[model samples]
Structures are given as C-alpha cells and as structure tokens.
Target: MRSVDADLIRQPASVLAAAISEGEVSSLEVTKAHLARITEVDERVHAFLQVTGEAALAAAELVDEKRRAGAKLGALAGVPIAVKDVLTMRGVPTTCGSKILEGWRPPYDSTVVARLRAADMVILGKTNMDEFAMGSSTEHSAYGPTHNPWDLTRIPGGSGGGSAASLAAFEAPLAIGTDTGGSIRQPAAVTGTVGVKPTYGGVSRYGLVALASSLDQAGPCARSVLDAALLHSVIAGHDPRDSTSINAPVPDVVGAANRGDVRGLRIGLVKELSGAGYQAGVLQRFNEAVELLQGLGAEVVEVSCPNFDYALGAYYLILPAEASSNLARFDGMRYGLRAGDDGSNSVEQVMSLSREAGFGAEVKRRIMLGTYALSSGYYDAYYGQAQKVRTLITRDFNAAFDKADVLISPTAPTTAFKIGEKVDDPLAMYLNDIATIPVNLAGNCAMSLPVGLAPADGLPVGLQIMAPPMADDRLYLVGSALESALTDKWGHLLIEEVPSL
Candidate 1:
C-alpha cells in the first residue's frame, strides 16, 4: 500500500469507499495511514483531544471481515471520520473540551455516532473544541488551542476548530462538528474545507452535551459538498429519544449534490452582511463568489433582512442564558472532576469549588453573565427581550425566503486570526459569527465553503449559503454547484492551493 499524503486525503469519501470495497486497499491499511498522518501533523495543529487508535483499527478489521464475507455494506464503509467531542460515543471520554467533564465517558452513543457506526465509518477519535462550545476560537478549550493547518500560529476557527484542522492537516477526510453560532462553518471557512450545518432538528441530539439547546446543531465537515451531503443523509432523521428531533423525512441530499447546475436558481445576497463590518478582502472574495454563481447561471439578487442588525446581541443573550441552565447539571457529585477533596466542607462549597476549578475563565464569565441575565430583576429585560429579538430574526429569514430560494454571505467578517488575538475580549470574539447566527436562530440550514484566500493575511475565506427550514437539500444543490464552478476555475480545491508547510 502507498503512503497517504495531504493530496490523497483530499479525495472524496465516495472515492475512498469505492477503493476499499474493491479490495484495492484494506480497511486496516486506511485506518493506519490516517493514524500515521495524524501522528505526523497533529502535534503542531492540536486538532484532537484524544485519538482512538486501537478501537479504530479493531472496527476496521470487522469492516474487512464483512467485505470478505460478501455482505452488503454502508456507503461510507471503511472511511475514517473525526467526531467532535460534543457528541457522545459510548466508552469514549466526551470532554466537550471542558475541564468539568474531563475523563467522563457516556454510557450510550449519540444518534449521530450510532449512525456513523451503522455506516461502518471508522471513528478516528474526539476532536478539541471551545469549552462548552461557548466561543468562536478554540483557545477557550481547556485542553488548549487547535492551530490552523494553513499557518500554524493562526486559528482554525472554533468550537469545531479541531474538526476543521484535522481535514486541513489531512488527518481525516470526514469529520462531524456542531454549530451554534458558526462553530462548524467558520472553522471550515478558515481551513478551506466544506462544513454544513443541517436544518435545525434534522440531526438528533440525543447524547450531545448541550450548549444552547434551541440553537446547537451538529453536521458534517469535509473537503467537498457531496461528502457533506453523504454524511448528512446517514445521520439525519427522526429519533424518538430526542423530543426536539424533527420527525420529517430526511431528504436525498446526495441526489441534490448530483444536480449540477444552478441555472435559474435565485440566490439571495444579504446586503447587511456585505457592508462595513466585513473586511475588505473578505468582501472581495465574496463578490468573486457571487460572480462565479452568476456565471454558473444562478440569478443573483440583493436582499435585506433588516432584523439582522440585532442578531449578534440576541444570540449572546440567548446562548448564555440557555448554557447556564443546561450546564447546571455538572455538580461535583454526578460525574467527572470534583474539586475540594476536603470532606469538612458543605455540599454547596464542594459544588462551587468544583465548578471554580473545573471551568475555564470564559466559561465562568459566561455563566456569571447568564446568571445575571436570567436573574429575577433582569429576566424580562435581558433573556425575555432576547427571545423577542429571536422572533424578529426568524421573521426576517421568512420574508427573505419569499423573495429568494436561499441566502448567501461571507461566513465570517474576516479570515482566520492569530491565536490569542481575541481570547481576552469575549465580545470581539463573539462578533465573528454575526452573519452565521441568524440561520441557527431561524432553525434554517446553512453551509460554508472556501470561496478564496484573503489577500490581507493569505488565509482562506468562506462563503456561506443558507436555505429556508427543511430546504436543506437546496443548500447542497447550490453549494455543490458553486464548489464545482470555483474548483474548476482555480484548477484545484482551495486547500490544495494552499502553500505546503
């Protein structure tokens, strides 16, 4: 067997699956190659919190046995996928990159994890993430930061930074990540990978550690839209275990990917996102992407979702308020790490001490803010008002959909920044997701693909494509079309064009 390099890992999962099925390569060989690649590159990138080597190879051996037995296999049989720590996998420690839950393993698997296993996908391991998925940069992770593969000193965007960095570093071809406010898409944008946040409730969240219950969603990260669609199809559908999981039938996203042209497709460009707040280089790349869409026969139009101006504020309020309530379950007695070993202290002292020791600074800050926002005197003023704003944001998206099939924007205001640059200022870091948050609030589907590299810093920029509720197939349709057009124009995938380290 040949060694796997960055270019080889960039091949779509479908191609790898085909090769594995034909006996061109054994599942064990594929798993070992990915593990070697991670060993070579991940130390500098800090992409994974844990690497499940023995278990992954053991699963691969089973896949090989099934192949030899001539049994039917899943579409992604033998493919390796990096799972974000936010999703629970039985017997694997799911830290969610928080010290509070360090070394804690769930008794059961998340719906997405189960689906991946059913598909015969090899679980590479848990990736690093922001503590409780609270920040836009992975610097807040209790385990440490994940660096950008493009430039080791820069960020790879966050919460899903580990997933994005893994793809960029050629550590894995497919990864699963969660998005609350641009966690998946932003990381994909900066790392030059394709990341999709399926329509809210499209994928079940049965064992996912909650960040913001109403807004958090998990989806696929890969090098192409088709791969994302493939992973999305397998994991999306109704799950009886999660009450909020949508009962609607999962669409044939792969079929949508096969629909090549965007001819006569009405693509809306949100005017608000392209304005002053956006970096000049980001806007340039965004405009170029729009031009590519037009050349591909898409009917591009400028649309305004006037309520978007308030989205950032609304999200900050709602996310923290919900996070405070959801994270309250992490008392000293229930799970992983516990502080204050002295038995003389009261129960309340033990709980407080554990939290104070376990949580990082950002987590503490958010908890305090959330507690204040939801407190008696401020509940109506802060949390209640934020809910009203969320309603208005949803209305704005609804009105925009009436005019266009989908909306587009720059996934982030700027390209990947240097690590530690925004770690001190929570507000500044949160602003990075201004454009992507509204979609989550509206329970719509969205995806981000590398549009082009920004000239200012030479880092990749991402173009975000969004669709109305349950219109997830449309995102894949447009995203695949745009990806095909852009890659053809550049003569390579965005990540392929990056300067090799």
Candidate 2:
C-alpha cells in the first residue's frame, strides 16, 4: 500500500471516486489512509472531538465488499467525511461541543448524515466546534480549541473550525459543517479550504440541534470547490421532516464545477466590505482575485448593499433570541448532564444549577442576552427590530442581483489569528464574521475559496463569492473558475503554496 500525503488527501473527490471505481484502491484502504493520517496529525491539530475508527472501518469494509461483488455505488462511495458534532448521528454522542450534551446519543441521524450514508461515505468522526456553534473561533468548544494546521499557535476559524482544520491537516478529504454567521466559510477562509453555506432552506435541518433555527445551515467543507459540490449534491434536497427545507429541485453542483467558465459573468464587488474593516493584505489579495476574474473575462461591477452595515448588530440580536428559545430544552429533566443535586430540589433549581455547570461563559452570556432581548419591555426594541432589519438585509441581496450574477468579498477581515487573540473579547470575536453574516440574514448561498497569501503574515486569505437564494450553482461556476485561474498562476493550490512551517 502506498502512503497518502497531505496533497493526496486534498485531491478533489471526483478524482478519488474515479480511482475507487477503477479498483485502484479499496474503500477500506482509503478509509485507513485517512484514519492513519488523523492518528498521526490530529493530536496537534485537535480537529476531532471523537474519531469513529471502529465504525468507519466497518463501513469501509462494506463498501469494499460491494465493490468486489460488482454492485452499483453512489458518487461518493468510499470517500471519508468528517461530520460536525452539531449534527445528530444515531448511536454516537452528538455533543455540540457543549458539556451539557457530553454523553447524549441521538436516536436518529440528521438528514445530512443520512444522505452521506446513502452516498456510501465513510463517517470519519465528529469534529469539534464552538459550544452551540456560537463563536468565531473553535476555542469556545467545551472540549478544547482546534489548532490551525498552518501555524499551531493560530486559531482555526469557527464554529466549523474543526471541520476546516481537519481538511487542512489532511485528517479528512471532506467534512460537513453548519453556518449561522460564517461558520463554514470563515473557517475555510482561514484554513485555505473550500467551504459553502448553501441558500437557507436548500438543505434540510432535520435532526440538527438548532442554535438559531432561522439562521443555522449545514453545508460542505473540503479542500476544493468540486469536492464541496460533490458532498453538497448528496446532502441537499427537500425533507418533509424539516418544514423549512426548500422544495426546490437540487441543481447539478458537480456539473457546475465542470463548467468552470466565468466568461461574461457579472461579478458584484460589494463596496461596503472593501474598506477599513478589512486587513490591508486581505484587501490586496482580494483585488488580485478580482483582476484574475477580469482576466477570465468576468465583468466586475461595484454593487452597494447598504443594509450590510447593520447586519452584525441585527445578527447578534436575532441569533441569541432564537438560540435562547431553542436551547431551553436542555433542562436537567430531559437529557444531558444533570447537576449532582438531590431530587428534593425544585425542578427550576435543578435546571439552573445544571445550566450553570454545563454551559461555558459565552453560552451563558448569549442565553441571558437572548432571555433579556425577548423579555417584555425589550421585545419590540430588540428582537422585533432585528427581524425588520433582516428583511432589509434580504432586500439588499435581492437588489444586488439585479446588477450582478454574483457578489464578492474577502471571506474574513484577515487571515488566521493567534488562538487566544480574540478569546477574551466576545464582541471582537463576533466581528470576525462581519463579511459573512448578511448571507445568512438574507437566506442566500455563499462560498469561500483561497485567493492568495497575505503578505504581512504570509498566511492564506480567502475570497468569498455569493449568489442570491437558489442560485447556488452560480457560486460554483465562479469559484471553480477563480480557483482554476489562481492555481494556474501560483503553480499549486493556495495551501500547497504555503511555505513549510
């Protein structure tokens, strides 16, 4: 058996699928390669909360047996995929990186997990995440922080940081991640991986532990756009179990990836995102990306999304409010960690004590803020007004599409920062997603791709591409085109081009 390098694990899923279909490698072999890589590198990266070695090997054996029997296989047959802990996987402890759900096993799989299983993917393991998917860095995980693979001291972007970091660290070829405010894309941006947050409702949320019901969305994180698209196709579709799941037909994302032509495409550059908030190196890389897009014949146009300025404030208000309500189910009686108090204590007392011991400070703070936001006197002033602002943000996206086929921005203000840099200031950490929050507020589709390395830190920076609701295919088209052009220019993928640490 040949050893797999970091670059091999970073290959597009299509290439791996072809290799598997041709009997070049057994499913078990591929799974073992990834698992071995995880064992070798993950201790330093901290990408996974749990590594499902036993189950993954068994599943891979099934795939290999089926291949030997000449049975048909799904497009992703034999691929290893890491799942974020926020999504429920039956029989596995689905701890959303919170101490509260430390040992709780879900009774059923999330819709996305079911789809991956049906696609014959090997479930590598559940990756770490921020508690309830709330923070910009995975440092908020009750378990521990997932370190950036590029520089061990730096942080991987969150709350999907572990998934992104796993790919960057070559622990898994593909991963599933949830995004409320940039959870998928921001992490991908920093890790130099590809991550997509599809249009809200495009993918079913059934069995996913809700943080902010309206904003939370599950999508793919991978080393390339095509790999992300391949996973996206398997996981997206209407599901009756989730009322909010869009009934719209899922498009051929893989086909879009193959098309990779951005000629005559009208790309919108949001003026609001290009200014003071962004790091200067990020801005320079972004401009270079724009030039590359133009070189590929894309028509770059400035588009104003005025309401975007208020998106962060509105997002904090709405997410906390909804999260407060969704998280109320964690009271001691139902499930998860219970305080050691005796049964003689009142139910309210037990619940309070359990939450105090279970939740981290950030989670508690958000819960309290949410409780207050929904309180009588503040309802209209906070939650009510935030909803209205959400409407306005949605309108801004709708109007932008009138002038452009897609919108673009720097995925994050800067590249990966030191792990503890923003941990002390919650507000500063939240601000990291400023470039990504409006997409969730407006229910649009967005993707982040590595554009180039930031000069100051020589770390990778990502360019974000977004499309209006249901136009997810356009993002693939643009992102694939940009990725192709940029890689050709740089002589390797962005992550590959990084200087060895």
lDDT by residue (1-501, candidate 2, tens digit) is 244645456566777887887898777878888888888888899999989999999999999889889999999899899999999999999999999999999999999999999999999999999999989899999999999988989989999999999988878889999999999999999999999999999999998899999999999998988888999999999999999999989877889987998999999999888789799999999999999899999999999989899999999999999999999999978789889579698888889999999999899999999999999999999999999999998898889999999999999998999988889798899889999999999889999999988999988899999998888999899999999998788887887764342
* Residue 368 CA displacement from its true place in model 2, Å: 0.8
lDDT of 1 at 79: 91
Writing each residue's lDDT as its tens digit, candidate 1 over 1-501 gives: 244544456577878889889988788888888898888878898999999999999999999999999989988899999999999999999999998988898999999999999999999999999998888889999999999999999998998999999988888989999999899999999899999998999999899899899998999999988888888988899999989999989977889998856899999989888878889999999999899899889899889989899999988889888889988998879797888879798989989999999999988888888898999999999999999999998998988888899899999999889998999998899889999999989899999999998988888999999998888899889998988888788898888876554
lDDT, candidates in the order shown: 0.90, 0.91
Q: Residue 328 of candidate 1: its Cα lDDT?
A: 91
**RMSD (Å) per prediction:** 1.2, 1.3
What's the residue-level lDDT of 404 in candidate 1? Answer: 91
lDDT of 2: 0.91
The ten-residue window of minimal lDDT in model 1 covers 1-10
